[model samples]
Target chain A: MTFDWGFVGEAMPDLLTGLRYTVQATVLGYAVALVVGLLVAIVRRGAPPLVAGTVHWVMEFIRCTPLLVQLFFVFYVLPGVGIELSPLTAGVIGLGLHYAAYTAEVYRSGMEGVPRGQWEATRALSLPAHRVWLAVILPQAIRRVIPALGNYLIAMFKDTPLLFAITVPELLFEANQLGGQYFKYLETMTVVGLLFVVVSVPSAIAIRLLERRYAAV
Target chain B: MNFFVDALPLYLNGARYTLLITVGGCALAFAIAMAVGILGSTRSAALRALASVYVEVFRGVAALVLMFWLFYAMPLLTGYRLEPVFAAILALGLNIGAYGAENVRGAIKAVPRSQYEATVALNLSWTQRMRLVVLPQAWAQMLPTFGNLVIELMKGSAVVSLIAVSDITFVAQQLRTFTGETVLAFAAALVTYFVIAQVFVALMRLAERSANRRLGRIPARPRRRAKPAGAAAKGGAA
Candidate 1:
């Protein structure tokens, strides 16, 4: 059968709405991941041994399991317990929490990358722990960690499709729905795939630039 | 809840299937990675470009999309039906191959320039130089990254559940459906994955130690700068 670009063009608006949701979920998910990951990193760093180990184990547990299963768990189990959320909320939280485990590792590396002398200097200056962490440690650590964090962002972006399992109206799920409705898997999925490349390519180039800049410094 | 406690054998069977998918997927991913990595490193510009595009497209797209495509869209596109297990393996193998290609390429590039020069000085052919000199070091360096990839592949294989593969995740859903013991099933899935990931970590550390011992005796020589004239010639030829 001959290819049909016309069918793809007609379906573009629906896919674009899906794309908008994809971008929103990715951005919101990354924001949550950054915040949660930082907290996890801090807890892992200086909490009492019991607390520290628990955090470590939980992060490991989160990292090992598949996000798809986690999505299902939150969607099904949360409602049973009366903590209902929209599928989009559940999907974002799932993606956020999963990537947070990974970002915590990145944050740990960034903290380790900060020189011991920097800590000593903070101690010598008698800065409060919270202030030192916010004013001194995080600034440097987060700077060095941009590329790693960018990788997580890209990963979270790719993983947004797991939302489909929970019936979130994201790009992939929308494409699948469109495909089913029209029996046009070729156009819908093909466009979705190309859109992924178009967005991800610039993000990847930006990450490389960030890496080079840090390397030079 | 009572049923979950009693139906342990069925859950265990699901876990077994999860392990099967992981092992099978990892093996296939490793093979595809090696081929793609080597081919991507070719001097032929067209070959390199093709490999580059394949790696980027696969790696950049979501694995779930790939799985869905293979499971549902492939049949639609090609009129060829595939069993869920086969589709899972194909999607995972292709996805992991893309990421693994980057690791392998980076690992090869990480070999010092002077080593390549020394191989030339000994009058070794390109094949001999790669086999005897470059790849051994690259293999060692690639071990940790490859281990991480395997862990990722294991995690990714759970997506096969969407296609009704009777893997652990699917089994968890089945248990939840039959017994309404949501937490128990979810907890089992979590613990199973944790144990599997821990095993991979332990194995990787062991491999790292052994590789370190094998290559330990010789200290790495300092990297030599390539002569500007030779670099110019190679660049021009390429």
Candidate 2:
């Protein structure tokens, strides 16, 4: 019914610690997404017919399912297959793999958007395929998709809370713990929600700016 | 394998709830999104700001967090016990509505200036201008993005499991807990969601064709393949 500044102040340290884990998971997860997504797009592009088509379907499957379910699958289901992962590792891998499907699409578009002439030019110049990919196509593609990639970073940040299911000590997980400990949701959730707003609002605005800037190009 | 046969009824029930929540939430979200979108697109600065705050707040927080707030916090704060299905629908609707509002605004804005000029030249009233002229064209543009939102909304519906909603995901989780067969239960979930997404995409394509047909134009090449470039990240894109 009323605000509690004192409780908020006392809970600040724990939430900040959780925020740290959230950021770490985000950075690590997004790093995995960046590398994995680019690799997927490149492989899918050059893949043999069956492989490419199967990869496409798999990517679609990953994108369509909920991340919360995926996290549960990774953390719970993988153990049945004789794979065990720590909460943080499972969370990061789950987050990374899910967003990778999206970023892979982004990368696929960026790569395809490159002019046909450039690929032909590389061939004409007798550049090796890897050189063409590494030195030519990817640089341009990556540059074009940087903001798209950055938007994923913010998305991954907001999504880290889903890791709470696996007991990862992310921001919302911390808030949930605090609420359970004290039997109060108003203060803990309000603080955590506000923290999310603090981070996400500006980034959303920035993504809009990036979109406008890229539209001009 | 045998477990799946035994769990068939549960999965079916789950699917029903999942489909119901998605349909209900998306219907409400579409109305809310259009209202907020029109508000954001209006000439009045205050109205635009109000709409902006709603979008930012809802869009910024994850759906799971909002669901928690509504389910756990609301009951505590207001002493008004909210049903899990109601909470799930309200949270998912509000959450997706924020992104949908943004996309709606984009589609409305994408209606060319020439179209507005044509409305003015024809002496159409403001309502006629929006309903007759701007909206039809905008609806065509909005479909592809709406398709994405619908898929995302179904995916987001999985979060209702967190609050014990009897959606497909919740049912899967319950079956998993009871049978201790996590792989089968969750794999079924993944495949079910995939099939739903495919069906949604097919439906959107049909709607797009009809919309274009309304304008007396034959539907041509699918624009969906080209849409992800600019429209990525519009609806949580998660």
Candidate 3:
């Protein structure tokens, strides 16, 4: 029960390997979310009423449910339908898709924040729709939402521990494994918790800075 | 469909625990939020520093990690084991309270300076000013964010299954193993959780409407345009 520096030193290599996967999952998962969310937001805005309404409800369904259940559904149900995925892939998809629901809302608000005059000017200049979206609207909209997106990025990073449920050897998974192997849950879990704090606190401060800078602009 | 029908009672039983944890966690979290939030916004430097440390440490860690630490590790240090439900509530309350504290602080600080000066000029004590004036307004501002936090806590409670809490997620997993109905089991779980979240959302909206009405920001009756015109006429008469 007493704190053990020697045990921590022994656990560091496996923990570091787990940290690598954690970062990888967060980056890859967030990449999927950002792109998929933008598509969802755009479609909800421009699609026919039936399609848009369906997309909206689907997003709500995903948003309202717990992410852990979604992970279970993807991992367990997909194989029955002849689409097997590795634990890592399943975890990434679940995290990405669940968070995309949230990010889509952020994207919608960011788009709404774009001034009406800007849209009117785009139409006045006779710009094509794609150009208007890519060259003008998205650039401004995305810029304003970067801080909000960054907050989600940090949230996803903290949530990487949930990947353990699907047997991904992420940080918490490694710590739990070590705890079982050595019967030292106290030290192993404490170290893992500290690792999370170390990574997240600095990122949170940076995001606060980003928020202030964007607000000034 | 038969599998789902058979599993409904089990899932509902699990959902009872889920609701218990959510409500218990939210109560504890709200208490923590009020304490830390008020301390954080106070003029005392030491109190602010203490509140910030609590906020950052709890907010930065994953709720799962905290749950594991409490359920598995803390017993080693403290020589006392926690019940699974109590540990889940404690871990979640601590974790979500960190986020809710920021909401409380922000809402309190957003109260106008003139209002604070008016309370002081009226010779009200600190508690009286906060209870009567500042908090009534701040409570309304905090409700929306607290609603979101309650949902977050409810979702986060699913992680309690890892600690063998037999919540909805745990029961769903059991149903899956029993029936070999992966999609049905989890789909039922998802729908159940979604329904609970929608209920929380509805409750929060009612709270917000009532809070606004208490402040006279909304008319007592539903005639919006007429009430505004009537308010204008009363202003002109005055």
Candidate 4:
């Protein structure tokens, strides 16, 4: 019925454990998303029509579906086909894959924003294809896309709670369990929300600064 | 396999709830977004800050957390419980309103500054200028982003499953639990989501076409008349 700081203080240790999981899942998941997204973006470029269309459709489909259902599917369904993964592993993969679809679009747009002349100039110099991509194209595209990708990471942070459905002991899950045991949803959930904003807000500001600095060039 | 057949009716029923949440939440969000967008773009610093904080909070927080807060905390605080569907709609509308406000703000700003001055010179008040000059142009700029947000909303509605809303995802989960046909149920949900998202995008394209038709004529007709008259005057004077 009211705020209970004492219960919150008592639960701080367990909450910290959940917080560690939240941070790990978000960081690891984002790392995976970054790599997978790069691959998707690259595959789309210079691919045949069917390959391109299939990639596009698959990415869009992944982007549109809820990560919660995806998490459920990965955790529960894959075992029937003989792929075994822990709940945390499944949750990370789900989050990473879901956001990878979005990040690929960001990468594609960033790559497109690179002037066509840049590619032509590279070819005219007789530079190796790999060299062109690594030296010129990727640096520019990745720099341009850092802010959007950072925002997605922040989103991934907030989304870590969905892992709770599969029994991953993240912040919200910990808070809910604490609440159910002690009947103090107000303090626990409020702290969880504040903690989320605490991490996300600064990261967002950093992303904005990065966007401004790069965009000016 | 039998699970798929037996749970067909429930999934179909669940699909209706899913549709309702998506459509209902999106429609409500669109209205809220427009209002918030208008308010945010008003030349008042205080109002702008208020809207900014609101958008940041909703957009920054996960939709599931917002839903949990609304469905769980709202009832506790208010002593009046909203039904799961209403809570889902409310949480979703508010969340999308936050992001949609940004799109609206960007779209409104993308309209040339001269347009606002034209409205001002015509002695239109602030509200009238916004309604007549700003909104129509903003709507055009807003369509594609709005389409994307609609898809986001449809996917977001899946979070309602957490609060025990009997949407397709929830039904699928139930079927999976009951029948162990986890893959089939999930694949069906995924495909259903994909089809529904694509349909929303397609409808947005149709809306964009009609909107372009309306806006496309506004500029061309005036240009046509002005150019011919100028040529006629130049010829006669020579």
State interface RMSD in Å for all models: 10.9, 3.2, 12.7, 16.2
- Of the true interface contacts, each candidate retains a share of 0.40, 0.59, 0.64, 0.41
Cα lDDT tens digits for candidate 3, A32-123: 99999999999998899999999988987887678889999999999999998999999999999987887887788789889999999999
lDDT of 3 by residue, B89-203 (tens): 9998998888888889889999999999999999999999999999999998888778778888888899988888898999999988988988888999999999998898778
Tens digit of per-residue lDDT, candidate 2, span A20-81: 99999999999999889988998899989899989887887888788888999999977778
lDDT of 2 at B165: 78
**RMSD in Å for all candidates:** 6.8, 2.0, 6.8, 9.0
For residues B1-238, could you state the per-residue lDDT of candidate 4 as single tens digits?
6666787788788889999999899888888888888778989999998878877776666777777776666666667778999889988888787778877887898899999899988999988987888898778778867877787788888988888999999998887888777788899888888788778767877787678777874434321111111111111100
* Candidate 1 structure quality by residue, lDDT tens digits, A124-162: 999999998999999999888787788777777888887
Q: How far in Å is the alpha carbon of A112 misplaced in model 3? A: 0.8
TM-score of predicted chain B, candidate 3:
0.91
Against the native chain B, what TM-score does each candidate's chain B reach? 0.86, 0.92, 0.91, 0.87
Tell me which of candidates 1 and 3 scores higher on TM-score: 3
Output the TM-score of candidate 4.
Answer: 0.92
Kindly report, for each predicted structure in the order presented, the TM-score of its chain A compared with the true chain A.
0.97, 0.95, 0.98, 0.96
Q: What TM value does model 3 have?
A: 0.95
What is the DockQ for all candidates, taken in turn?
0.37, 0.58, 0.43, 0.31
Top DockQ prediction, candidate number:
2
lDDT for residue A54 in candidate 2, whole number 0-100:
93
Q: Could you give the candidate ranking by TM-score, starting with the highest? A: 2, 3, 4, 1
- lDDT against the true structure, per candidate, is 0.78, 0.84, 0.86, 0.79
Runs off by more than 4 Å, candidate 4: B1-5, B217-238
